[model samples]
Structures are given as structure tokens and as C-alpha cells.
Target: MTAVHLADLLTLGARPAAGLLLSLTDRCPLACAHCSTDSTMASAQSPGGPFRALVSSFTPDCRPELILMSGGEPLLRPALVRELTASAATAGTGAALLTGMFFARGGGRLPPAVRRAVTGLAHLAASLDAEHEREVGRAEVFRALGAALDHVPHASLHLTAVPDAAGHAYLDGVIADVRRRFGTRVPMLVGAVRPTGRAARRVPVHPPAGRGATGRGATAPCEFAHWPVVDQGGTVYACTRQSLLRGGPAPAHLVLGHAARDTWRTLSERTLGDPLLRSVRTLGPVTTRERYGPPPAADGCATRPGTPDPCGSCLALDPATADATARQFATPGGRAVEHTVLALAAARPPHRLAAARGTLPRYADLVELGWTG
Candidate 1:
């Protein structure tokens, strides 16, 4: 089939922007323990220029149907939202925001300009996990949720479920409460803790189990194979996990060409003809066998200095070991590195499925405390 035909099929049941995850900025207001972006805003200030440039590049031909603006907190850069929303609207794409809702409460309301911008978009997703609640304050989150409800009618709440009993309980309560207060209109998406960012240091990483719909249960075919990530640094990758693991190197790391400069034909040829993809198809089952082997020890970088061995649920488990393994895969004959990444992405459950499937009732059972609905 043609590439356009393949892209449409891949996104058949996916939500808006189902194929890509764009990191607008690494900066965030709250220092949540389990952030996937590993964002701290320590990088450059505003991504408006890069984002606008990307939009301009995609206009007329390659505009993505769904665009998600994520960061430390997207609302922190209100102007970026305005620009992004306008660009997406002009390009006939839907726009969404993923944030911590830090500014939603705390006497900080969504500015009228932001509200106007949001009205032009499709959806808004606010994070409300335990760490986010602690950093941004729950009362403020609720207020922010209410405020978001006021402007964006299609707003949804995301509650991250970290490993361990307490984390699970916290997520449960948050979901229940959100459902009670907002009903199904503002659905809740439960995500598992990923081993990236500061969370890699603070939260313990465990073997992927019951992490999400796919992680805990069945392994679905990856839909992200055709979708690519366009990071704020102007780099593109086949997947966000690859971008993070490779530290944003050349597109060759993920076998993707520059989205801004390369034509879709060039990108398709390179991606489909990539040795990495071939190796993955060959070695995926073998690596799957090794993944269930004895877990690594808790010493060294696996556990941050002065911190307890949170390795049980930690994503940084054996960074040295994993790096070594990755190197082996990178070896001339092994190609095991490529297989390992595919295995990880396939193993890790995606929280987006619940949101995409509109399964809010399952999440509502968790957050029962102080539920307003």
C-alpha cells in the first residue's frame, strides 16, 4: 500500500494526533517526581519560534491532523498556545494541551486570550497524579479543572499511576473524584510511571506489569511506527522513547530523516529500509525472552545517591547495564540495540488508549476520596 494509505490505516482508531508526541518545552512549573519529558525549563526559554517554523513547514501538505502541545506545563506559555492553535486551525488540524494544571488554580486563572485560544482547539489534558497534586496543590488543581471546564468543553484529566500501594491508591482517589465532579464529560486517563526524567531518579521502576491496558495485558501492534516526534530542538524521531534514549542525536538514530527538510518520500524510504527495522523484525522474540530474566541489583546508578532503593518501580534500573546491552545491539552483527528499543516501547503500556477508547468508568473506581460528582 502507499504511504498515505498506510498512515490513514495506522490512525484508523487513534485519537487526534495519534501518531506523534511533540514536546514544546522541557520547562515546567511543578517539579513532579514522575514526569516523562524530564522537563525542567533549564533549556531555552520559549519554543514559539521553533514551533511556528515547524507549522509553517508542515502547512499546505504535511499538516498533522492532531497536534499536542506538552511541556513542564503548556499553559505556562500562553502565547505559544495562541500561535499553535491558530496554526493548527489554519492547517485543518485539531490541537490539544497536556499540562500540570499548576496555573489553573492559585488565583492564576486562564487568561481571556488563552480561553480564546483553547476554544479554537479540540481538547485539553491536565495532569493530576500524586506528585502533581503535591506540587501544584489539589485544591488548585480542582479549581483549575473547573476553570478549564469553563472554557474548553472537551477538557480531560490525566492521573498517572505510579507503582507501589500508596501511588496506586492516590491515583485511584484522583480518578474517582474527577469523575464524581465532572462526570464522563471530562474523562480520566490513567497512565503508568515511565522510567524517564526526574521520575527515573525518584520513583522506583518495576518490571512492566499492569502498568496500562497494553503493558499489563495483550501486546498490540505498534501504531507509532509511521508517526514521528518533532522535538523543540527541531529534531524528529520515529518515537519519543528513541529521542529520549538517544539524547536527540541525528535522525538516523531512529532512522528518521529531518521532517522539516526531507520529503515524505525520503522519510518513508529511509524508515522502511532501515536496518534497525529489519533487525527488530528478526530479533524481537529473542529479546522478549531475555526481558523476563532475573532483575538487576539495586546498587549504583540504579538508585540515586542517598535515596532508598526505589529500583522496584524505577525506569533507570541498571543504566550501565542497559547501556552495555544497547551497545551490544549496536554492534555490527548483533543489531540487538534496535530490537531492544522496539521491545521496550512494545512492552510499556500506553495510557492514551484509555483516553482514545473513552474508558472513564474503569478509572472512576480509583479516586473516591472527596469526590464532588
Candidate 2:
């Protein structure tokens, strides 16, 4: 079952930003201390009811370029993975899945169902890091990936570590090892452990520092808002920030709509065109906050010194403020700037997107690893 190269996706840059992040379940077998999705054996699992229905709604002309299935561990629901990938394939949409490799602890045998699910995939990205290494040995993961290379056309590594010296050293060694074994056959996306989900208890939230801001302290446009995330409960969000989508009633601004009630066409339209979302994507949350928000000093944001947390300001927006944002971006100059941002991003190599988003600055080059170009 040959599939598309992972580099192909990396090369897409956020241009059209036409991709979907569909979380299959919130249940994971591994207990990595740094797990972001906070997965556990007892975590909530989502059946593919709305998830399937949404994918089924895709038409060839309107479908996303790619559909990325993730999870607490997507492989746990192998049948659903197979079903959705098959559905996506019919629409000329590419599909990929990410996992922590729970089945590879010992001899690393791919379960029959998992093998079936992985067949015909565009790619499979396996997670490995200090915590994952402890939960599943490095040897086991390597062996499992070696086995996978035979069935999948493209495979890659999704690694996470503390963004410090020790973490860098660990990733360097693993990347070297993967190359020694696979000889550039696999690329890697190395990232810092996000302080969300379970890890939040131990690590505080901090977007990477040194990100630039404008003269008035507005932040870089939030590339995060460009994609839509479908959480386990079928709730769709402008981005996958766990805090943004938690529980009973979501803030109206962040909630795009539920997957059960909204089709992919509807979600895509809302995500790409919603006034608030457009502002978040074009000018970034912090900039939008300042350009249309209360004086920074009055909000206590200016008093903090340095650019305020981008997402924090974004989350603070009200309907009226969002409307103000809509009108701002609707202007000719604002629209030109927005078009320039998208054009510049699309014009550059995709690795730049990886760097801006959070792949360690040093390892971002590896994003295009093994590409013939």
C-alpha cells in the first residue's frame, strides 16, 4: 500500500490552510508523563458517528487537501481509522495517522487491525521522546518503525522533549539513529512538550519566547487559528488549544459548531471566513486585541511589559470586539496585508511553517528531510 510522501504535506505551507485535525479518541494506553491529550485507559472515547458523518459529507470539489487523524492514540480505534481513510480516499483527499506506538513495547508486532488501518495511508507518524522512550523502549519503537516502512510509503517521527540542552541532545541522537537505520527514508518533526492536558500540572503554559511583536506589541499572526480541530465530543474549534474547547459551554467565539450539526463545507467556510478567525489568522490575537481592544494599560496588559501572551488576549475577546476585528480586516489595506501574509507563507518552503509553529528552530530543516527537491 504505497502512499504520499510526508514532505509533500510539509511543502504545502499554510496557503490554503486546508487541512483537518480529527481526534479519534481520548484514550491512550501509554502513560507518558508529558502526554498532552491527557490520555488514560479511562479517558473518553469518541465513536465515529459525527466524525464519519462529517467525512462522508466531503465532495471532491470541496474536500480538504489532507485529513490528519490523531488522538489520545488513534490506533486504539483501528476500524474507525480504516473507515475514515477509505472515505477520504474516495474524495481524492490524503489521509495520515499519528500514534505513540503502544503495541510496540515488546516484539513490536502490528496488530492485524492496525495493519489494515494503516494500509493505503499517505503516512504514519510515530511519537517518541523521553517519556515515550520510557513507556516504550527506543529499541521497540525503532523495530516497529522498521516494520512499518514496508507497508507505508512514507513514515516520519513526531518527537517532543524539554526545549533545553538535554532535550536537544536526546533528539539529535534519535534523529541520527533513525537516519543510520532508515538512511533519510524518514523525516522528523521535533517539538517542545506543550504545557497542556496532563503535562499542565507540571509545566506552565508558555508559547516559545523571542517571537516578535509590532511597535505596539502586537504578536505574530497566529498560524494556529488557520486550521480546524475536531475534539472527541465532536466539538469543532478554530484551533486545538485544550483550554479553548473544554466542557459544558464553550465560549461562542471559539466554537465553530459541532460536527454532528455541521458539514465539512460549513466548517471550512466558517473557519476560513469567520471575522474573528480571519483576524486571529491574519494579524494574530495580540495585535488584534490592541488594534481593537481596550487600552493595554487599562486592561493591565500593557503594564506587564513585553508582548502579552497572544492566545490570552485572543481568548479575552467579546462578540463586540470580534466585530470590530471583522471590520478592520475587511478594509482594503487590511485585506492586502492579510493576502500578503498568506502569500509569503505559501511562497516559502514548508519548513518555515514548522519553525514558526514550534518545531525547535535548529531542527526545522529536518522537516524537508529526504525530499528529492
Candidate 3:
């Protein structure tokens, strides 16, 4: 109930999914080459009406604790942003926005529409990275953030860097700059560039894995499944990882529900009540397959690290497999493991959770950049 910090949100994965990520629009004015959403002015987007209706369904007792809005650039729909944020307030659900800061390039004061949209929200996050720098000057972005700090309750940066020497140097310098400028008032959520969106074709994408005849043997649970992500089409999926939602028929296991047809209560219940989903959240996809699945096959499912192209082993489920997953995860033993795994993962501070979930190790320490916590 205290003011929320960027570091605090990064750690939400360790707990029951209290957050939902809603992609406002796929249309971005700035074409950052390394973007994970592959957003463009021409890209498809869903209507704001359904999205508004969905958020309108939240009740004080059943709504998500947090709702994070992003897109090719969520600011493109400022009016909807303002509406949804106000609606969230009525339900006691906090709202936040993640933007590319397209409006910040020239470095004057923020446009009235952008300021009005972000006003009274819990937080605002600006995206800065090597790729984004090519489109928007770092100085300009910083200057814009400086101006934005006026209207919002809190402000932060979401930096994306590929892991390497250059990445660390950038993080160190930028973090230092932020510290000097904002002192500890600003916090950051630093992450590595994954093989998603435009980068997928260039950067080889690989999920973490281990070798096994049956995925059931390993205990690596996927906490990412906790936060349900709603794409621009109003379609909701289990994780925020863009790659999982942008293409193909959503692997059956990950599809939650569409915002148009489902209320917050229905979605939240499905998220928390489904045994298969709970298993994936607690035991991870691979181990869920191993525990309740047929012998592991190399069908793009992640296996031992040495195995080539270690993708998620349990991408989807068949009818019989879903049944087994439901039954097995329903048992007392399964419930025990779920609580234990969640407890262990949640035991750390928010920054530590960020470190374990793929933020660069050396610079990972900097994710705790602001806040006394």
C-alpha cells in the first residue's frame, strides 16, 4: 500500500500474478530497429472501446493489483490511457505506462495530451536502449523525462541492452547520469534484449533448458506465466514475452481469454483456478510435460542445454495431456510443491528476482537503482 517503485514491480513474478500487461496499440511513430514488438505505423491494432470495457469490469475485490500498459507506443492513445487509468482508480487497481517517449525527441515540455494522459497515474516508464537511441537522442530522452517527472506520482526508466561489454558500459553511464540528475527518486528496470519481434530473425532465441527423458524430473518452474499479457488485439496470453503472443495460434496452454468476451473476474479466476496453468506457473512448462506428459521429444521443446535450439518443451497441451496435468497438479503433493516453489522464489527482494529472470548479472545489481528498499 506504500508508494510503488519500479524495483517493486519487477519482483511481482515471485508472487501470485497481481499484474496484467495491456498493449494499447501496435502503431509506433518511431521505428526503433531492435524493437521486440515489431511495432510500426502500419501494424495492426485493436480498438480502445473493448479495452476500456475490459478494465471497466474490474471490482475492488477481484481485480489485478496492477495493470501495466505498453505498445509499439501506448502514448499514441492518450485519451484511452487517461480513461483506463481513471477507471483503475475507481477499482483501487494501480495503473502504469511504458513508452518509447516518441513525444520527447524534441525536448520541449511534454504535449498537453501526453501530460493529461499520464496525469494521476501511479507511474510512467521510458524506454531507452542502443536501438532507441538511434531514433531518439539520449539527451533529449533525459530532458523529456526531466519534464515528465512533474505530472506523475513516480517516474522510471526501462533500459534494454544486449549482454556484453558495451551493454554494461552504457548501463553504468546512464545509471550514473540518472543518479546525478534525479538522485534516488528515479528507479530502473533493466533487461536484456531477447530474440523477440524484429530481433528474432537476427538474434538467435533460446529458452533455458536441461536434458531429460521426461520433463517431470526437473523442478525449474516458470513464474513468467503469472502475469497475463493482453496484446493489441485484446487477446490475452499467459506471459509478457512478446514472442509468445505476436505469432502463430497461441499455444493452447498460454491463451487466457479475450478482453472483449471476458471480464476481470472470469480472467482472474481462470488464471488462478486452472490446474494446468497453475502447474506451469509452479513446475514450469518443461517439467509439467515431463511430470504429466509423454516422453520428451525434440519437437522444439527445450531439453538439455547442449541440445540445439532449446525452446520451451511444453508449448501446448493435447486433450489427454491436459487431463493428466489437471489431475496430477490437483493432488496434495502438487499443491505443496506449488506453495514451496512460489515461497522460495518470492523470498528475495525485487531486484534479485529481476536478476534471476534474465537481467544481466553485472548490471543486474543496478536494477535496484532507486528507492530505500
TM-score versus the correct structure, for each prediction: 0.65, 0.91, 0.90
Write down the TM-score for model 1.
0.65
Per-residue lDDT over 163-185 for candidate 2, one digit per residue giving the tens place of the 0 to 100 score: 77887899889988988988888
lDDT of each: 0.51, 0.77, 0.74
The numbered model that scores best in lDDT is 2
lDDT of 1 by residue, 1-373 (tens): 1111111222322321233455667677667777766667575454366567666554545556666677656666777787867776675666777777666546647657666656665667777777776677776677766776666646666677665678678876776676677665565556666656666676555432111111321123233344556566656565434423344333233536544576434444544444433322333312322342124343422323322222122222233433444555567655554455445543422333333222233453322222232
Report the candidate with higher TM-score, 1 versus 2.
2
Clashing pairs counted in every model: 17, 0, 8
lDDT of 3 by residue, 48-165 (tens): 8768878999998888878889998999999999999889879888888899999987764588999899887787889888888888888888888888888776788888776677
Say which prediction, candidate 2 or candidate 3, comes out ahead on lDDT: 2
Q: Give candidates' CA RMSD values in order.
A: 9.3, 3.4, 3.5
lDDT of candidate model 1 versus the reference: 0.51
Candidate 3, poorest ten consecutive residues by summed lDDT: 208-217
lDDT of 2 at 190: 84
Q: Considering lDDT, where higher is better, how would the candidates rank from best to worst?
A: 2, 3, 1
Cα miss at 244, model 3 (Å)? 2.2
lDDT of 3 at 211: 22
